[model samples]
Target: MLPPSVVKDRVGRTLDRMTSQNIDALILFSREDIRYLAAFDQACICLVIPKEGNPTALGLWLDIDEARRQSWVQDTRGFVPQYHLRIGGGEAQRRRLVEVLIEKGLSRGRIGIERGLLTLEMFDTLKSGLPEAVFVDATPVLKGLRIVKSKEEVELIRRASEIADCAMEAVSQITDVGRKESDLAAEAEYVIRRSGGEVLSKTLVGSGKRTLCAHPFPTEKTLEREDLVYIDIHPSYKGYHSDLCRTFLLGRDATKEKAHETLVAAQRATFEATAPGIDPEQIYKAGISSIESSIYGRNFLELYGHGTGLNVEEPPMITKGCREKIDENMTISFFQGALTMPGSYGLRIEDTGVVTKKGVKLFTRYPTDLLR
Candidate 1:
């Protein structure tokens, strides 16, 4: 659940985006955007037509319960309910959506829709149903609105980080030298659900060298005495997702002291380069340079970190060749890892961080070391 203030902020920003772009009405269907503007959590394709006077949201009749519970609209009781076709093609909702627009004096006004995520088929359906209204693409408008984070949204992200931190702490305790990758991952989810964390990204614990594969699913591979462990965990708390990763070693001699020193140096360099107004490319290079000059080879995981928010992955990536300016309240991750570790072991460490006026705020507070 999200704070009502956050939902309102999102809706207000989206309305401003639509209004400034000269959009007559907004027909929101994207799941993320829908949740952004209104807290609609049902798994149905909903259409939201916002007019100058009144705004109407349309969804499947079956989702009325969920829509009512989630929507933060002040007058959702006044919203028109329409039933969607089970076949996902033609729906009674489409006709009613158009009819509601016509009633709201939008017969000749432009209807805005998120174009990037919507399909051509849906566009055809909307156009066919509302032949009188002009359809205008609103992808850029919505993105521009969402790019800046409000204080409420920022608080959600911070709360999400605390929940993710609890989950990782559980994993740190349960993941021993002999635990299987699958067991470690399953236990991660166990703690998350138990701690009231919403599991958005699938939990994965890659043991030993297998951790090098970035998005590897859970495996039955058993942990080794000298293996490296990387846990990729993303959990949603208060409707905001947290993306965090931690890599550690197992047994008494999991990683050599020299290797640990090199990685610590790299991580420090990356952290030093992180700030509110630093160039992302150069900051990423600061960390990668330590790896290349170390005993390890040139490449070690592709980039440093990506932005984390509603989605685990987002733009404003902290990677080389990215020319975007870093701003305050922009949360990011720093994955200072060594996929190119000598002796064929994956040693990667990641943490969620936020850009502040002075430096980055580290969210995940767990310690990084080889499991013994």
Candidate 2:
């Protein structure tokens, strides 16, 4: 859980952005945005944040008690859902949300909504309920506020990265010949859970030829000698996520060993290119230049990386054509890899870090060397 002051600061920044954009109130639909504002972590809950008043949270009757206890908002309301409605199950709930908005004197004012997350049916219902109110897309405003991380948020991300490191260490110690990839993945997840961290994404474990694919899931395939194995772990603490990936080898192979070395160099170049006042596109170019200087350059993939914080992928993307400048206290995940050829083994190295005045401060500290 975050401190009261930290939560207040987050809400204050959001309110400031809303004022600048002339938005009277914001109706949040995504769980991430709601949790970030009110510290509530439940589903089917709607949050209404006014520009100058205390925020309100609307939830089901069964979850109102928990919402009141967990969320920082003072005005929490409950509504009973009528499942008998065949067209839409939550008509009653939606009507309650609109009623609350109107009661708050926002019926004729401009309302901000998450267009990407809202369903077409819900949008229609809201439009019909508040015909005078103008609905404006607030996705950019929300993303702008969330792009920079505060001191407390950075600490949570650091702790999440530490948990990922522990899980990867467990993977390195328990992996052996003839062991199933699924078994290793399960062990890694257990390690994260035991350390009081939640698994944000599936624990990806790929070995041998399966490593060619970027996002392969663990399978029943048995490990063999000289096979290359890689694992990607995403774990979270207090809603802050960390992305980490590392590669290993069952036995020694010169070609794969060289590729691992090149990938590490590319990752280092990316880290060196990251700092305050630098464009993210420059960082991506630096990484590509470093990779192309190696023998495995032609095998490099196009996808680079992106920002990581409340969500696994966020703003200030580290890719081509992104003109966003990297600012201090921004957290980003850097990934660079290469496949020798189609259907052939590959190697990748990724880590999460925070941008600083000088350079990036890495959170994931697991060794990147290919395991023998």
Candidate 3:
């Protein structure tokens, strides 16, 4: 279903914050955020900005049907009434937005935008087009609101996790010797979406040293007795996604078995360390406790985990140097990396966890043990 209430509350909160931040308007570009506001089903370029009377969205003629739906939008209209087709001329979109901003009195006020997603070319275009506008960094403000999940959002994510768990279960049952990594990945995807999962990303089923490479795509790598097979799935259900990683023993890998035991311990430590108000560094330490300190000292290139919500990645990072406190209702991913020599296997066991007032709750329920 459409997230009308979430958008409504979000819009209300955003307008309140805009008043305090002195932001007159925000022009959004990403589809996810646009979907959140417009509640549209189709994907097309659209613009949304706050104004004196109501928020406005502008789209090409192709998205007229979707824009008219107004799932979360209070008001919307097509860019040109006469034009019955989509146009992508850089100059045309720029001029229309400038005119809208000027009419809304936002030409000289603070205009919010996403700096990372918006290109430098587009930034220059907006700047050159609207010389009087004072652009403000709205990323932080919007991120703050999105980091915490509402009850409804959490429910949707839980539903996604359930579907992912079913996919993993099916994959485990059908997987055996003589099967290729790609075959297993296909089975997982097939079972997952058929059982109501929306496949948001491609699956990863790497074997042996291939597992050492994070996000290794499905390949024809044959199974080996002493090979460590790792499968990771990032799935979306009801528009909420779950990113999970699990390991498997192709035949009888002694190194993989030992690594699995160590990783299980490390994951347990990480889970135990996670709770509302706890420092995220403490969680990272737990993830690395089972391994040697030198490994983390020299090879810690990525974050321990990150918050997950509407998108695969969310704000309020769970990593070192980040002080974003874990609050109740915040949903986050708990991931542990596997980087070492010898067998060259990376063991990452991740789950969607929610922060509660007293403790943390994991949405994923699959067993962590790898077959020997």
Candidate 4:
């Protein structure tokens, strides 16, 4: 949990943005977006931040207590029975939101909603309730606010990275010939949970032919000698996510060993080009160039990496076409350190880091060496 002051500053900044955009009120629907603003982690909850007054959180009656306890907003409300016992689905919540808007004298004003995340049913309900109010998409406004991390957010990501490192170490110790891919996944998840991290997704443990698949889930396939194995762990601490991957070989292979070295060299090149004011494509091209120079040149994945934060993947994607500049405090991932050869094997090395004045500071420190 972040300090109350940190949350307050975040809301204040949001309100400033709202004022400039002439948005009367902003309603956040997605759990990740709500968590970003209110620190309340309920998918059924909605946070309404008016341009003038304090923000309000609305949730189910059963969740109101926890919502109030966890969220920074004081005017947290819940949908309970007024007469007949009925907590109608999406419509009821939108009706409650409409009433709140009317009460706050914003019925005829411009309201900002997450068009990308909001349901059509809820949008219609609000439209029916307040026919005069104009609704605008607030997705860009919110994305602009969340692309950069606060100091506290960076610390939380660091802690999550540490937990991922521990999980990788645990997986490495237990990975051996005859062990099932699921077995290694279990070991990684156990370490993640015991280290105060939340398992955001199933740990990916791909070996042999399965390594060629993108984001493959762990299976019962048993490891064999000389098999190429990779473990990608997704863990979260205080809603900040860390994505890390490390590849290894069950036995020595000169070609694969050199391939791993090439991947590491590509990662170094990528890092060298990452800094404030540099284009993301420049960083991407550096890795692509390093990999293309190697014998395994044709295995380049089209993507370089992306921004990560409240959600595993977020804005300011590190692709060739993205127009956003690399700014200080932006949390990013170097995920392009992967090479794939269909029907044969694949290898990857990834790390999460933040851009600072000095350079790109990586959080996950698990060695990139091809573990034997």
Best by TM-score, which number? 2
Candidate 4 structure quality by residue, lDDT tens digits, 1-372 = 447788778888888888878898998877787888888976577778888877787777787888788877889887674311122354555677778888888889899988877677778888888899999988656867888888888999999999989999888888899999999999988888899988876788899989888888999999999999989998999888999999989989998898889899988888888889988888888888888998989876654788888888887688777667899999988874678776799898889999999888999999987866
Candidate 2, residues 213-320: lDDT per residue as tens digits? 778799999989998888999999978899999989998888888888888888899999888998989999998998898887788876487888878878879899
Candidate 2 accuracy as TM-score: 0.94
Instruction: Write candidate 1's Cα lDDT for 173-255 as tens digits.
Output: 77776677888788878877887778878886777667767676888888777676888888877567777777777655623
TM-score of each candidate? Answer: 0.84, 0.94, 0.88, 0.93
Which lDDT values do the candidates have, in the order given?
0.70, 0.84, 0.71, 0.83
For candidate 1, report its TM-score.
Answer: 0.84
Off by over 4 Å in 3: 1-5, 79-89, 293-303
Residue 29 lDDT, candidate 3, scale 0-100:
73
> TM-score-based ranking, best first?
2, 4, 3, 1
> Global lDDT for candidate 1?
0.70
How many steric clashes between backbone atoms does each model show?
2, 0, 0, 0
Ranking by lDDT: 2, 4, 3, 1
Which candidate ranks first by lDDT, i.e. highest?
2
Error of 2 at 168 (Å): 0.2
